[model samples]
Target: MVVERKEEGKEQLIQRPVYYISEALIESKQRYPHYQKLVYAVLRAQRRLAPYFHEHPIKVVASTPLANIIRNRDATGRIDKWAVELGVHNITYESRHAIKSQALADFLADWEEAQQPSSQADLRHWTLHFDGSKNLEGAGAGVVLTSPKGDVVRYVLQLRFEPCTNNMAEYEALLHGMRIAKEMGATRLRCLGDSDLVASQTSGTCDATDANMIAYKRAVDQAGASFAGHIVE
Candidate 1:
């Protein structure tokens, strides 16, 4: 989770990062407890950054005592459903201090050493990359993936139908990065891409005589047979 934006720079305010959200933890939330993983990372960043917490007023720095333990009034079960879902946003809470910029203290020490915590045999195989373009600032597509413990996950798409083509936005960014690496359970994926006609018509050694590239190569061969080992470099 990242969401910076401070600006002003000529001799003052700086902070940069725009938005990045990452979750992946369910195994009983990797055994929470560190103030319930800081109120489950601010209630999973207010439910995955709900439109930037419904247009910003956020401020949650944290050194603990997270807003008096979510306004504790003997908060019960799951901290009373996370203080009633973070009391409908307009949040506040600060405290964490002392990092007067040495390039924002080396980017929060390399984003807290890339958020440590690895092993599961270092997260067995996952790496994807995709791209698509349509020019004139329109049709979009992009997907990144990574995570063998390197964790990357990025996505962006826009192709709002109506005549899209650059190999149909590279098979819609390789079927939107194989449905976000099979919803992140990724049973070994690899799929890097630059689109040699969408990686030779989705790996059938090229032959998609355009009827929308044969229905996007049969929906990318049924999303690469639901991946249990995929490849399409």
Candidate 2:
């Protein structure tokens, strides 16, 4: 868990080893059932962080329905004991609504392997390239998509609306390429673009400042989430 607070009119995020713990379960302890194992992990976390938990309120932010599992009347054995022990703490459980920070985003992305297909047969990989060019004439975008079987598909998009910056054009090309790849049933993709700013922004290395850039980032994130695996370069 991470702790953050406002200090001197600035946000401060702190990491203290005293508040963290990691331990491997013993063979007997590890033999618990899946739901009971989850209960044990939560109980262990709270106990290890007891100093901080005793001083401040603790909230569990998770995608799983932890509360429902603990509150069920049929819970027995270790699950029931762990639930009773956890009830003493001033803790609340809340479902995750959205990614609030880069740390949390990384945590979620680390667990996204579960979203991948179970069967690897006929799994397809895709390569994408995006570029925007403008000279004395109008602006246009060039996109290339490569299939796992060495098939190459290319496209050129001509701007029909108002003139846009090179970065905006790059985003447009990337968005367009991703849409086509999704339609073609590509589950894993690697994207390459000449625009460093656009690539870094899309991959969360840099922040998007302007309204247009922010909107583009949202669109790119939404599209990327549809794929089981995605990497932007």
lDDT tens digits, residue span 1-233, model 2: 76655556555763222333333343455577786767666776775577777888887767777889888788886677777878888888778887555664454555555555666632656999989866567778999999887789999999766768778888889999999999988888888888988876775446689999999998987797677667777
Best by lDDT: 2
Provide the lDDT at 95 for model 1.
83
The 10 consecutive residues of candidate 1 with the worst lDDT sum are 18-27
List ranges where model 2 is wrong by over 4 Å. Answer: 1-124
lDDT of 1 at 204: 40
Q: Which residue ranges in model 1 land beyond 4 Å of their true spot?
A: 1-47, 55-59, 63-91, 96-122, 129-161, 183-233
What tens digits encode model 1's per-residue C-alpha lDDT throughout 1-233? 34454566556555555444343443455676779777877876675467888887887777787888899889887777778878888998878786433554566677657744355643366888898989877799888999787879899999988788777987889888888888876766777887777776555445578699988877866676665456676
How close to the true structure is residue 183 of candidate 1, measured as C-alpha lDDT?
Answer: 84
Q: Assess candidate 1 and give its lDDT.
A: 0.73
Instruction: State TM-scores per candidate.
Output: 0.28, 0.52
* lDDT per model vs. reference: 0.73, 0.75
Backbone clashes for every candidate come to 0, 0
